[model samples]
Target chain A: MADTNETVLDMEVIGALRALEADGAPGLFAEIVELFLTDTPPRMKGLEAASDAGDMPGVEAAAHSLKSSCGNLGATVLVDLFKQIEMLGREHAPEEIPSLVSKSNEEFVRVQSALLNTK
Target chain B: MRIQDGNDPNSVGEGMDRHLARYHELKDSGEMPGLSLPEPGNRVPASSAADGKLRDEIIVQLCEGVADERRVQRFREAWTKTVEIVSANRSGICERFPYDEFWSHSLACGLAAHALSKQLGRGNAEEAFLCGFFYRVGALALSCAFPFEYAELMELRSLSELDELKSVERDLFGMDHVETSHAILVDLRMPDLLCATIGELAGQADGGRSELAYLVLNAEKIAGVCLLDESRGDEEWSAIMEMRRELGLERAEFAELGDAVVRKWWEYGDILKIHTRAVTTFLELDDTGITERSLLGLSKINAMSEYGSPLTVLIVDDDPTARVILKQQLVKVGYRVLTANDGADALSCALQHSPDVVIADWMMPEMDGLDLCRALRRYEAGRLLFFVLLTGRGEDEGIIEAFEAGVDDFFVKPTHQDVLIARMTAAKRVLNLRRQIEEDHRQLKQQLCRMAELAREAKDAAVTDSLTLLPNRRYATRRLSEEWSYSERTGLPVSIVMIDVDRFKMVNDTHGHDVGDVVLQRVAEVLREATRSGEVVCRFGGEEFIVICRATTREDVLLCAERLRSAVERFVTEGLAVSEKITVSAGVATRDETTGNVDALVRAADQAVYKAKELGRNQVCA
Candidate 1:
């Protein structure tokens, strides 16, 4: 489970999140996970729709939003993929973002399951 | 120290460094003036202006180093633009921008820069003036654009040193005034070379800036020192000395420069109608920091407001997640937290709730944290809000900007709970200090009112008889003299009725002093009640009373005396051991040709009382 967690969500990011919790706090890590879970799907849909329509600015905005949320959750692979898409969108590289968006979606599913299991 | 602490916040720390630094610089060159600086009063007076032409000549003098007419014209245009911006925005920016202080410091900078340019012979005086005048234009722009934030920044800057202020501004506003000034100068169509040099020089520490930038920076420092209190910190003194030595300014030349800047500052103050406090000379900068420090060093005694009610914190951020995170952490640490989504909402919330501390995000959609802070600072109640800015930007300049925007504390994004708690602890200390100050003011006001009330009471007590609740002998004599003078002036008859209790000593001996006291009190009540308007009644002495009647005839005065005698004779004394009815002897005297003065009038009345006693005790005598 530990190895799986490391593969899905970066352990260092998890450690940092855990550190945010106080002595008797309900837990910042859990709250952040919930925020990531609820927030990411719409952003993922937005990125896919924008990429399909070849709207680079739209893709960039959606990707930018997802990157920060994924970064907080230690979903390193998704963060990396979304970062690529965001850069591509910024640079107006229309052809490359669609593949990256699918990759982000795939990695996000793994991250979601892994985060839930930890909880 | 008192002067420093009580002075303008911008002037609190570095205000006296130039003077003190000049002292050290001179000492280093073995050319120290006497330990005391020249008196500030020795400077040239502000000359009366011939209005438009003299102003133009002063402008010419400022730009003396500029030889080209076209370039001079361009500089004049720029000067006009500066004036336009100030005049146009004066009303809108009245609450946020400190217009007097901004101009005072700017004009001083222009003067100082021009002086330095002339003294060092390195840069054109016109360029120096432009650089000095426009250097902090970004500060004005920022204050106008984001008033609350800029106000907060200034507030923070006042309490902090230059270094700390730089970081705080960066944290709060994403850029410090140097960058803001650079941007503004570029936008204003200032020459690129000049703008670039100023931008380069404004941020560098101690070394590695161009000579022009160096001159302008030192000029700015001089301007700050001139306008602010004379509080010397060793750090500031060393920095100023380093700059002085680098520029090779002799102590005498520096003193002259100070005098020149102050003289021009006063002259500009008059022409511009910007109020100016007298700028102190390097030697004349008063060092009252110790007294100020003592005043500020109040013990950290927690007030009832602190212990009784939980410290309320307003957390303002556009991101709900960020707000939740901060709120949960603060609430866990025993704070009563309120949340606002953006700066505008946060401000209204702050104004309504008056939170002890405000934790706001630097970046919001419409009005950011600094804007909210500035807005909050504009209102009297919001000035004390311990604003803590949360920012994603981690730059030092950004931090300084945040402080300048009036943020008490700055935290980078993804703040840890422990960090938040620690920041809150610091916030509480600041809040306590504010509360302590307010409590001190309230107590001082109460004490003043009490003292005033006591003074009024003391004034009254000097003339009032405590035993009879009437004017005493002293008051009677003074009143009689006043009446006598009035009668003398108006040729009106003024009469006096002197009444004594009949056999008062016998009454005291028979019934004891307590019963005699009751008799005297009852007789006083009758006398007080019987007198009409224009009749001044008083307890003259033991068992004796006097009444001064204005515009009354001798016959009427005799009738009034008899009325008092008969009233006392008829009244029964109640609640006393003795069953004796209280009575009084009566005498009347009116001011006539025979009456010499007020004293003689009283003597004639006393003689009539003796005559009344000889004839019969209860009858009236005249």
Candidate 2:
């Protein structure tokens, strides 16, 4: 795989790394990635349950919060996937949401592995 | 004194009793009882012709007195009031007032008075007012004196001839009211000119009269005939027509003046606590004689009507309320309106709609009006949008900035609505005129653009060497002039370098112009590649080329020139298929401030080139 620097990532990813270094924890990216990896699954499960129950507001609230967190972490692809989920949840289209959540999970695993491997 | 009727027969005494009885009988009959029993102080009986003469004299004297500066000034206020009143009631009077005799007479009297005053150089404008007021005083007095007979006469004659039958007053009252009034005026010692005019007006004497007085008298006569005709007889109508021509009154103008006079009478009567209908009738009777006054009044009415028309406006402001207020006020004034919100919107709207003019606000959120104004200048939208920047900021800097940004005009915010409407109206007119001017400008710009493109094409064709695609001699001169100016401004040394193909004609003669052309192209490529972007390199016609370098020192210019010469030599020998090896002689000259002319700079470079050629044509010289 190409390095993150060579890939077209959101500009905020650099800003987040710089912020972590400025906060006196230059090697804290792995811990933050682990936190995201551990926290996002339960949120996704909650969204799925709320959407299955036809609770559109619940689905929206969960999806929106998760999406913003992913954006903050500079996980642009995940953020885009979460945004689509939020839109779908708000629009009450729960039937087409499983595949999107699966894709987000897969991308999250990749980002998590990459973070764990960082020197 | 007592009288015994058949119903109340009481006995009375001799001669004194007989006179008393006669006076009582006259009083019982509602006649002028005092005529039979005169007042104790009266030494003279009221003769009809004398009184008529006196009334005429009094009227003339009154008119003359008003001509005096003091009296005229006093009357001017009254005249203005009369005009205001008449204007206010114009529609009402036109609807209600009698169209025939009375209205015509009043208009005639007003005109006659104006004419007389003008002829006499009298400053009293109120003469028209007064003439309209009292022209029919004689007729009114007669009506009062013989009420029963006048009522009978009014009934017997048609509505048009009320004034004409006044001659019958002599038969009924033993003296007409015109004579009676004249006598009273003479008794009061009025001026003789006045007395003579009254006599002329009353037909009491064949005296010399002013044309205005005659016009008034004729108007009155025509007015009376018009009143008497129940069906408004054609004969009376013809007489009125003749009177109109005689007074030089156009028919429409006569009607308008007549209506104005009636309106004035109605208004004045209301003010003075008199009967409005009665007063109107009286004035209308007088207007019949002076047809020109009616014509004058009509022209004035037409003028007033014209002034009542609405203006057109364009409102430009970011604030909705400002636009609404401006639009409302302008609409009230009968103005057509257009509105734009901000500078960019205003500009686009102005360009698209081509409004009569633009009223723009300065402090807009996006694209301030000044920027929009500057942009508008590039368009031939006629008179450059006639931009008016309405600003709350009154700083000199802001104002200066607006002007610098190409605002044609400026207005402070919270301008009076009326003033704004007026200004916008004026702006609209100017912009409309500019529309034509802008159309002409568009045509001219189109023409100029076409010419510029053609010139550019021609220049490209003439000044580019075909094979190398480098500028020829014509372009070299142009580049030199520009470079010379740039050098002067920056005080930086500019250098011109000239290079020539050594034996270039021989190459062309041996290999033909085609290969020679190829060689030239290759040399140009090398020179272009070696030179900085800021430098100008051109084929200086045939096998010679020139380069202009900005901000270059003398040594730098020489080095660059030498490098180019070496590159051309190396490329031709190593890379090109040539029968003979090629080399170039170069010359470089830096601009000298002491001799700042481009021609001089070129000459120096040319001399250097000559020197290089003298030194065996393969090296650079400066």
Candidate 3:
């Protein structure tokens, strides 16, 4: 038995892949994971720099990008976390951003490993 | 404020400027509120260099309020650039549009209104900005619609008596600029709240002045003092004082706000290529509220009237005298009218105003009305701008060219008043039909988008199993033949695996169907994970399943079958209703030269599955 927090497969992505039977081709699930892994780092840095500079517009742009991408990849927990950061970037205090960003980074590592394990 | 028909025509502006000076004499003496608006003279185009393209930053700056979070953004973007280009270039207007004065004044008034809107805490800053900038739009539409008579009215600027311009407009065109503008904006589908607010300036609102119009009036005068001739300072100061008394705006706070707007304009004025006579320091001010041009609260958008809005008519003729008579008749019978001197002016006015019908002289200078009709057709497909040429040439060949060039209907020159009016009335039906068609098309497109979404959902539902959300037996059955045909073409053996939940009925009996459902779902998940990309798995009714393996020989099929059997055995049933281990039996078969058909191959897999079940559960058979 696997712990809920451990790198276990998400049935949703596997189910989506099951529907698409393109023989001898790399599945959509792998490509989506690869895309998310590549897309998250620059965005995380952008959120950090924008928060540090007190640039609400930049923070909002970066947060919005991260939120949608995470939502599309079925990173629901990370998506919710990113949505909080995005709302903050739109209004209210930036002081709370660092903790959220770190939490997002930690959770994404689990998501990344779990997605890779499915391969 | 009303003006008595004094001998001096200049008294219209002169009387208002002198209203406070002669307060006792004029306060109780004046009859009504007249058109005391400042008429900005023609621009002396900048000597250095002039360009055509209106840069994006100007809209960002000028429409700062209106553009910020308003849903009317597409209109805002287009309107801002239209305003900027009309203000920036002198030649463009002299050629196309008839009225070229006071646009800079309009922008200044908009800026001042935006500044004041912020000060007053009025939530609709962008709307105020747009309303202020475009306050004088009615004046332009009227003057352009009847150039000759309007030019004569311009000479009457000294007569401080044309209190609403409604009377002078009534005498001449039978309708004033305010009425003309209301119809124009309504046709443009402008926010009704905005239209209602501007209606205050027309002195036609049921109540006195709307709060928005009061702020615009004060801000406009303040801007006039700062940007216009220094001689207008006394009038500006008096106007500001009166607005302060009326609106409760204090001088010091307003001075700060007005100065801020003037200073802000300097920072980006040159970049936007805006033409301005130095607006040095803001005059001592008194006002409230700011109207950000593009950013306004979305709440208060008047339920736009799509169908019943009045139609706009553009009158184009080289003879300004003839245009005046034509405009008077159109305005008399209640039509929102715009007029131009030639084809150039007519085309520009038609595009900017988007009038429902264009009435022009057939033989005018620089692109006759027929040629103008052809040029209009190039703008957007499917004849939105209706063209009617007034031609003396009723010859067969000329009429053919006019019709070929897309003239809707024609009025021969020196047309009878009743006859032309009747023609206009008939044209109204066609125009209304076009509007209805446009409304229908817009609704149909939205319906198509919804239907496409429903179709996507339906397609998803059709292919997936309800319980586990895996492909069902129907999907697997379809994929089997597809794989078999592909295998035949490539000479690659196709394999099948018949899977069954070993003693599924016993699991259900022991733990109930809830636990049975969980067991079946768990087994499906494990099988899905074990299978590679080229394999298809389906629930073949209760407890039974199938997998189609493409381009795979018997050996690979056997390995895949053993993997699925082991995976189902290892599936975790902890915390589930099932107490016993969950497992599935798999039987593998492959297509070969000896296999007669896909049915024979499937029968072989069925026999293999029964053998696996007979060989005691939780084992693979090949």
Candidate 4:
């Protein structure tokens, strides 16, 4: 199902991109987006599997890494969502993980589209 | 050019231009040393007192073959004595003034002048030394003539604004310090070379004041450098950088020389008990800096400690957050950490930085981790780069692909910092072990080189005194016997001058063996320097030397011995460990019709030396 409420590209990322360029690391945002696209899917898959298996540590670790990837790419909302999932996993409470993870996957899809278009 | 490389991370390109612009702005704004550069000519480059002895050593190195060591020593003594006389005379009138401080500054300038001249190969060390020390005569005269007034003036304005002070002095009393000093030195009948040295300080570049003159000016600057606060070291460094370039000095060489100068300055203040303003502590030689850099700077630590240094880890991930987490984890364990974004940057950074371990994300754009590994393998197998590829996909095919692409380890999507560090720690230990082995291999290579050097030296050194570096007794005997046979065949006379240091045992007893060793060495140098072309000088035994003067009779032999005696008498012990003068006595014997063999000739010389010793030491006897 298409999420109508989603904004593809986050405007906040433009500031981060400009800051990176000013730091003499121009063209870094594209590489960061590519890494986010490449790594998030597997990490998201790990969180889903670990949550289903009730492997709390596995879910926590996967969510944490995924959070890092999103944060770096300036996906602030996604990062916040992943942070909640990671905290829940760390507490061994997988009950709310299903809803959060589903939203995460949807957000990932939007992020992917936004990143490819930005590229 | 040597000071900063183009590719160096700490390049002074843009930053230096900014600093230069700021300096010019300050100049234009009349902040400091503006376009109103005081009067006409600049102070000649001269070394100051703190490292004057070290500068003299450098001068001696330059004068290796061109100037006689004895003559150089004499010149240095003359300079020292003249300065002592001038200052000693000033002590009567300027009793309350800080003469030690003033004298220390003069000494530093002289040494700096000497070192600069010797380094550039442009001017004479002697003239530079004389010019440097005596140039302060004007200030000394002012102090001596008008003690209270000079003291107030000096206290009001330190030497940093020496030119300003001079200008002020002229306003107060029709003559500046330099002018007064010049007049005083002229009245003292200072040599023309010394006078010309001071004159050149006022003279401009018609070929740049003989390079030595520039050194006199540089010495003044260097003395100022030693007086600057550590926080303001950049001023001194900027001046040194300019000097190094002008003198065509290599960066390392200049750094080494500067270190010597600073250390020598510190020592001078320590020895003289002069209450100098604290000098800048060079960062490279700082104890705490060394410890800190050893922890962080792997490459430098590798050079410093030949055994082992920390292994460098390069974390290559396009995700900046991932890279940061990984780098922080690695660095926490004391590994040197570097980071790169994506595969291309990783590749370039890896090649440039030469990290020991490289961890890369598998699916980066342009050059993915797998492709990066393969390219690295192809580019150089010697990388020992210990490639660890991070893949989100744990499928067998992807794993197989990673191996095919030459990855050494596989790390899954989420790397637990603890587990990663544990594995990397193991990797680091192995790398350190490898480095140790490499160090041992290098040391072994150096040992082989050293053995070769020792072998070469042994060939010559076996017959040479290790202390005085003169021909030993065995060589002397052999040389004399050979000369004797030649003399017998040619019917030409062969004479020997047997010289011994006067009361050498007392010298050893008074100054300890170290000073005794130096005295013996000095005496050898004097004898060697005094000998004629055909004379073969040798350290026959303890405090005794034999010179084989070929084609010479007793008269010629006595003359040679007398010259050597006079030279030894003139040698000063000011800079040496022992502060007492040393003398030598000699005896001459020639092979005439009555002489039996080389042994008899040696015996006769020995007997004559004893007679000379009995006839009051420091005389040549035949």
Better of 3 and 4 by lDDT: 4
Candidate 2, residues B1-622, lDDT tens digits: the string is: 1222422214434422332343334445664222122223443322356443543343443455354675644454333333332333232222222323433444445544554344434434344334433454344434444556666666665333445666565456544545444443333333444444554555534576665465455545433432232333345545655766666766555554444444433333323222323211112223344322221222222211122322223576555534544454444333445677766555555554455456676656566767777766645442345778765423245777788877767765545544665566556566556667877988999898678769978766456665687777888898788878887888888898988889889877755554576678888888888777768899887788899888899988988898788888777665444547888999999988577598888888889989999999999998
lDDT of 4 by residue, B474-520 (tens): 89998999998899999998999999888889877754565577678
Ranking by lDDT: 1, 4, 3, 2
* lDDT per residue as tens, model 3, A18-39: 3332321234446556656776
* Model 3: residues with Cα > 4 Å off, grouped in runs: A1-119, B1-55, B58-81, B84-100, B158-164, B206-208, B233-235, B264-272, B283-622
Candidate 3, residue B443: how far the Cα is off, in Å = 69
Task: Go through the candidates in order and give each one's DockQ.
Answer: 0.10, 0.01, 0.01, 0.08
**lDDT for residue B173 in candidate 4, whole number 0-100:** 43
- Residue by residue across B1-622, what tens digits does model 3's lDDT show? 3323442426434422222222223324541112122223333332334222334444454455454456447545435444434544332211233232355566677778877777787636666777777676655654544446566776666211234466777455434555454544544456776667665565544566667887787677666644444444345455656765565666665555665665445333443434544332333232423211110011101111133333567888665435545564554343556778888666655655577788887766467878788876655421676679875423235787778888888886545556876777668767667778977997998898567758967775455676776898778877888888998899988999999988889876654555577677777787888889988899878888899998888999999999888877776454333447777788999999999887898899999999988989789998
CA-lDDT, candidates in order: 0.68, 0.57, 0.62, 0.64
Badly placed stretches (over 4 Å) of model 4 are A1-119, B1-77, B86-97, B203-208, B231-233, B263-278, B281-622
Tell me the number of clashing residue pairs for each predicted model.
39, 44, 44, 28
Query: Tens digits of per-residue lDDT for model 1 on B193-277?
Result: 5687666755446567777787787897777765556465545544555666677776556655766676567556556555555
Worst 10 residues of 3 chain B by lDDT: B295-304
For TM-score, the strongest prediction is 1
Winning candidate number (DockQ): 1
